[model samples]
Target: MHNPPRILAVDDVAENLEIVFVRLQAHGYEIITAADGEEGLARAREQKPDLILLDIMMPKLDGISVLRELKHDESLGFIPVILLTAKADRADVVAGLDAGADDYLTKPFDQSALVARVRSMLRIKALHDLVQDQAEKLAEQTKELAAFNATLEARVSEQVGEIQRMSRLKRFLSPQIADVVAASGDAQSLLESHRREVTVLFCDLRGFTAFTETAEPEEVMRVLNDYHEALGELIDRYEATLERFAGDGMLILFNDPLPCDKHTERAVRMALDMQATIKAHASVWRKRGHELGFGIGIALGFATLGRIGFSRRFDYSAVGSVTNLASRLCDEAKSGQIIIQTRAFHAVEGLFEARELEPMTLKGFRRPVEAFEILGAMKQEEKSAEA
Candidate 1:
């Protein structure tokens, strides 16, 4: 609850002090009486009253002197003072005004006029207090807003840094893998060495070596560029991780770094897509007096995968028998052919038509490896009926 405003009345006559107290106290002001100027100044400083009423003819210090002292002191200077003087002395009234008295009430003053003056001074004091409170609140709100802006700028800077890091990752990793790594904020975990089952695919132009030997350097570069571009698109479409690309040869892996349930089917489909894409370019190459064909090999097995190389250069590669087996099968594949080992053939046997091939002896294998050639995907009606 709010406290009432305090008024200090200072007069040498006990009767005047009693009259001032009765009048202001009845109007709901808390009144403090003083019989002399010295006592009034002490009460004004100690109690810090909202208003002071002083008489001109006092015993100790006069009203004008008290007013000057009150105005001079920083802490007590703002308390409004009203001087009480006789009507005959106009010069004393002028002196009180010059001495920083806020208002005046002459001798034989009306009770209603005194009450009115007190009310006016207290109202002004309330407004000054309210303005001070609002100023303090505004300052606090400004500080909070500055802090919020600082936090927002920091978050924006962090996101920009993440985007730049993802852009650099795109140069090495596929778009899907790059996004996953950036979102998870844990590239080291993905790059750590681990062994897992994956489908490895290898592809290259069948006669790229001979073409490179006979064709001009610029022509060879153009053909290689076209071949890599087509294969790169299919690899991205299948969401496969590209391990490495050397000359016209490329290696891709699925179900590692990112898992895919239909990895075997994806690899076979991508290989067929490569053949169909090359067929369009084949006619153009033939018209230019050059012939080119594409072949692919797929194998499924567990392999150790991780980042491998020096600080300046590196690659995410797979190392195991599966990688070697895929390379050997790719080397043995003829033009427009896709060769797969027995394991991969079983995974997608129902989804595609494949012809079983005789067991063939391959490097690094003690026994001959069973293989098959995938013809094409089954028709939608056949797949749906089977399902």
Candidate 2:
């Protein structure tokens, strides 16, 4: 009962285009025609039809070239492309495959065969689109939770410290980073063991002065909600431990209380991801109209682990200079920048493209410390043109 999938048929010859369009339209599908590869590419970007039936030879551009372009662009790479060409030779088939065509049909093909292939490709496209949409929705939901948790942090800092560290072992193990600590026992038992290598990350929204002076309390709460909620999801994805939130900021420990071989890099990754998330959500806010910014800091080191607080008013959290320095670094970071200490940088340098920021001074620190900015994840993808 639903409308048929839209198909884009690309060919230079008006006759060939007519035959393919007529066959597909007879099956009750909406068809868009493109007489050349260039036009096909343009239509692909604009309409993003479910399936593209492209002829091998065309003016201005060719099918193979169009396929290459489509696969290269991140946005269009997933759309299915089926080559409808006259060339049936092995060499032609190999060339089409090399160019990234999803499937191919020789010219003078059967109407039934054409319909079958189009249907099959459209089915796959529908599934792919559905999965992508679900993933984006999930990410958005996680972002929402992190944002809500962020607001709650400022109000229930006391209750959270209590609820989070239900068991004594959780207290010393750094509950923020302890995903499996429950498998172990109380916080007191954790301190009995030797310390482990771990990275600690601290992040905060910079420009509190400007935000408070310029924005409403409700607006400020909304921004915090978006940032924290999104960061929580990303932290879960990387399997990093969230220690606790400090005011409008958060403290996360990596390879902590436990050993995560990738803790250092994961810390860097979380920082970069949080930055990316804020930018992605900024537009959502902008649509509703709001301005926002965030800052991140990371440090790595071994620290003595233990629980400290009255048995009645107890909590689980990290201590030592590593934690302090990370917090200090975050406080000192500029908006939208991820600042990392030298030790932290070397740990993830091999995996990330990190650039050095100027040495920064901390309130309680004796000297200006070395810091670096994470540019992005390693480049593994190439740009491609797509129709």
Task: Please tell me which predicted candidate would have the highest lDDT against the true structure.
Answer: 1
TM-score for each model: 0.65, 0.49
Among all candidates shown, the one with the greatest TM-score: 1
For candidate 1, report its TM-score.
0.65
Error of 1 at 98 (Å): 14
Model 2 residue runs over 4 Å out of place are: 1-179, 185-188, 191-194, 287-289, 381-387
Alpha-carbon local distance difference test for all models: 0.86, 0.77
Candidate 2 lDDT (Cα, 0 to 1):
0.77
Where model 1 places Cα greater than 4 Å from the true spot, the runs are: 1-135, 161-191, 206-229, 281-291, 307-315, 357-368, 380-387
Model 1 CA lDDT for position 263? 90
